[model samples]
Target: MNASDRTPADLLSSALAADPGRPLVTFYDDATGERVELSVATFANWVAKTANLLQDELSVEPGDRVALLLPAHWQTAVWLLACASVGVIADVAGDPAAADVAVSGPEPESLQAARACSGARIALALRPLGGRFPQVPEGFTDYAVEVPGQGDRFVPYAPVDPEEPGLIVAGREFSGAEVVERARAEAPELGLTGPGARILSALPYDTWEGLNAGLYGPLATDGSVVLCRNLDRLPGETVDQRIETERVTATAR
Candidate 1:
């Protein structure tokens, strides 16, 4: 399939093939004193492994709802793309009880939701690196434990149709093709131009603007994102410093 006909998964693959070494995601969490940068190839590898865990380990099928009760972090971005790759519908911060599988962070709400889900549950430690949870949450598998052993290359067992459901956020569901079209349609207003557009954003994932920063914008423009968690805590000077350091071209506050 050509670039326009391909899904988000295909967009990522094209980006990787075009420039594997370019930075795709630069993440920072001031609360945890954490910073991580992943290039196209590395991020794609993470998506591959996570997708494998979902399909091979959890037996998640196409059209399955995967609740992502996680905050705005790099791993959360990985999960979003992984779900899209495998044709699983990503429910960002949605109710886990209605989902087929739930991936949560180290938050009470996420924990409670994971426990309530009827299917497999996975909890992320949200450590500086991909570390195992110091104390595993009851009734949920630790994400770090299961992700590493999986293959770095992913080949889906079944085809993921672009017209199928791809994401659900804020009670709104969008198909894979619609997600791309909307992103592309909204790109200019969001300051996402052509290649190499770098946006540094400090927005929560529960809102539509936040999802653009975390997922759609960069994908639409073949650009990069510097995602900040707990950005409200940082000083203006520090934020400016990061903007300079990261070579950010735009900001979404």
Candidate 2:
């Protein structure tokens, strides 16, 4: 981890600088039998494009609130970093009516919640290949469709203040600096001892601990994650095989 990282965005930048080709997030969807891997450079590019979408197309400004109604998937990770880059507050599973923008997964509950958002509404298909939805949902723009059209680079219109609230998880707020601090503190506890540490996490993103295990802990420590969705559906032997195959050093407990 870089001691100079004052914000989550800085952590990402450090990772990109340290090893652009190293695996960053390896995602699995047991329910769909899908596995997708992204290197640091690829992940950062996705974050850049998504941040551009939030800033240029959606006109998201610093301190604005973005309700993220997504699961612990790769795209969710991208959105979290994008929010950091754009200096907006990412509210995990937050109330849509109170948010300036809302992003939802294709799940019924999340889609239903997103309908409450009167401002910008974006939806992710969550397909294995990141394909656009067969039919775009009403009142919402397809993230897969729009994000790819955005520039691969992003520069915030205003400088992001590390002191500003950057995330809201389970109704608790945390600044960008606080996020880095908390992640650093929790990294070793989750067995991410140093750089190149690989963690396998099946936790959801709705809680602080889940967020730490799935995203922040690894990012803060210059590590990587093997993120699993519907992990409970996988057989014990299959899960064990995956752990060995991913060369994971830790598992989120």
Candidate 3:
């Protein structure tokens, strides 16, 4: 699809319809030595709910930035898709202050900023950040529990304009239009599509390569994207398990 026409939501919907049963994301937690799998259909539902919560509870409007400090968990995927569905700008940061809403994980720099910036209204965490990372302080709304039952379905706030920025990648910025353009330009050489094709990537969602190539690009072409949580904790076996278990067809770096 052309850059002007394609959107992150369009790509996600395509995957949900084409392979509702297929594993869309597999997150391996080394500390717990467990795997969490999310199928396209289930993920879509969660994303919808998340979108509604952000809109209704937090009043996150289109183009508003939500910063993510979480790991490569299934929740992170859901958050990204949800933000895209509602036309909110998902600004993933290593530091939290740069974001409007903060999703805490291993990093806390951005979370601190989110608090200092005064724009941060909501904070989401898969687990408490007592010691795992810096605390988001008190008074900030905890999105983990508050968001689950807020919305039954996702309502599109606005049709995504590719020219508008969909996500903040790396330390730089890129618009949705840029991502679709890059995907189309590189798809032929990268071999980024086709049946049974899966992409395994260690890149963080905060990076351009990860957001475009790792997540959205693969989804656009009916391929699965495997996001690894701990890139440093590896014996190659973990990667092998994901490949063997998920039947990953390809990898990008």
Best by TM-score: 2
Tell me the whole-model lDDT of each prediction, alpha carbons only: 0.88, 0.94, 0.67
Candidate 1 local Cα displacement, residue 192, angstroms: 1.3
**At residue 74, what lDDT does model 1 achieve?**
91
Those runs of model 3 whose alpha carbons end farther than 4 Å from true positions after fitting are 1-5, 94-99, 106-110, 127-137, 188-191
Better of 1 and 3 by TM-score: 1
Ordered by lDDT, highest first, the candidates read 2, 1, 3
Q: Tens digits of per-residue lDDT for model 1 on 121-156? A: 999999988899888999989999999999999999
RMSD of each: 1.4, 0.8, 3.7
**Per-residue alpha-carbon lDDT of model 2 for 81-147, expressed as tens digits?**
9999999999999999999999999988889999998899999999987899999988899999998
What clash pairs does model 2 have? none
State which candidate, 1 or 2, has the greater lDDT: 2
List, residue by residue over 1-253, the lDDT tens digit for candidate 3. Answer: 2223466776667777566898776665565566667788877878888888877777778887878766566677788888878887777763455556666543355445556545545555555221121354464666655665766677766677767877776767666666556765665444566655677777766666666556666666666677666756877786687678777777765
